[model samples]
Target: MKQPEIIFILRGATGAEHLALEGAVNLEARLSDPDRRRALVAGFYGFHADAEYCLAPWLEPVEGLDFAARRRLPRIGADLVALGGKPAPSRERPTVTSLGYALGLFYVLEGSSLGGRVIHKQLSHTDVDQRGLSFFDPYGDQTGAQWRAFIAVLDREHAAGRADSKEIVAGALDGFRLARMWLTE
Candidate 1:
């Protein structure tokens, strides 16, 4: 059987995502400072709110999918308030039309929670977490299981040839690029 397009995408997008992560927000520094941490959280919330809003119509049709469960805007907002910051305005939105492209953006969004586990661990050692960690630790102990479930779906989509590789990859790349640019601002 042919390898799933998701596999190729994971392999191909790693470098680009890494570059984005490196140049994006300074995770370590932000964790140590309450003010910076609030800024980081708010920034990410704005970006995700805009992205998810654009992708909502496309993603809602996927069965067994819960957009509210996947959303972190509320948590980020709460965290910002806890830290005495207001939720900023939404950022520039991405254009998404197809399910394949929508899933591609979701790939980036869900994968972020996977990465968030690490940040969550780091934040736990600080008082900042008392403020809020809904964004970083949205799934809490269920993070791994949620990720596996999402991957299973993605893999199935690839195996069933339900998605177009070009569109998926384009969405993923666009997601990474825009997120990185947003964080740097």
Candidate 2:
């Protein structure tokens, strides 16, 4: 049988972890409270900042992918500051040793934008000030396009034998686990 696409494999491998992280996030409840929302953004900055720092070097050589443009640290930091929280120094550096692994970890981070769009929409209907909400809707109208582009790069990397499916799945799972631990703490 033909192998499944990397994205499909990642989704299947990470389904349970994804659900667990979602439960931990409790986005609706968190977004409803100012303190919780600030904490949430601060957690995001802690996670994404470290993840970006770890993955950037590995992703630098990937052709057709502009890794810098995908960085969310600045946006997360801005959101945290807007929410009156200081961005903390990097705590833990998640291991991203290879291009394949970096791509896998990136899959989880980039995939978050999809759900973030929904959260951004929901927040719009609330009474909360929108100053700190930019991170959730970072792409504005280009979210779908950006996701498609990332997928294309992922597929290209896999097809080029630069990334192994197992490594990708493992990275995604670790990404979810790390995200949950950071966000929930």
Return the top candidate by lDDT: 2
Model 2 bad stretches (over 4 Å): 1-4
Clashing pairs in 2: none
Tell me the tens digit of each residue's lDDT in model 1 across 1-185: 45465867765865668566666677777766777777777778777888889888877777667766787777777877777787677667898967667778788888788788887786677655546556777898999888777767777766667767677777777787767866653
**Candidates' RMSD to native:** 2.6, 2.4
**True-structure lDDT of candidate 1:** 0.74
After superposing candidate 1, which stretches have Cα over 4 Å from the reference?
1-5, 126-130
Candidates in order, TM-scores: namely 0.87, 0.93
Q: What lDDT does the true structure give each of the candidates?
A: 0.74, 0.84
Total clashing pairs in model 2: 0
Residue 48 deviation, candidate 2, in Å? 0.5
- TM-score for predicted model 2 compared with the true structure: 0.93
lDDT by residue for model 2 over 98-185, one digit each (tens)?
7778888898899899888888887788776777879888787899888888899899888889888888887888888889878894
Candidate 1's TM-score = 0.87
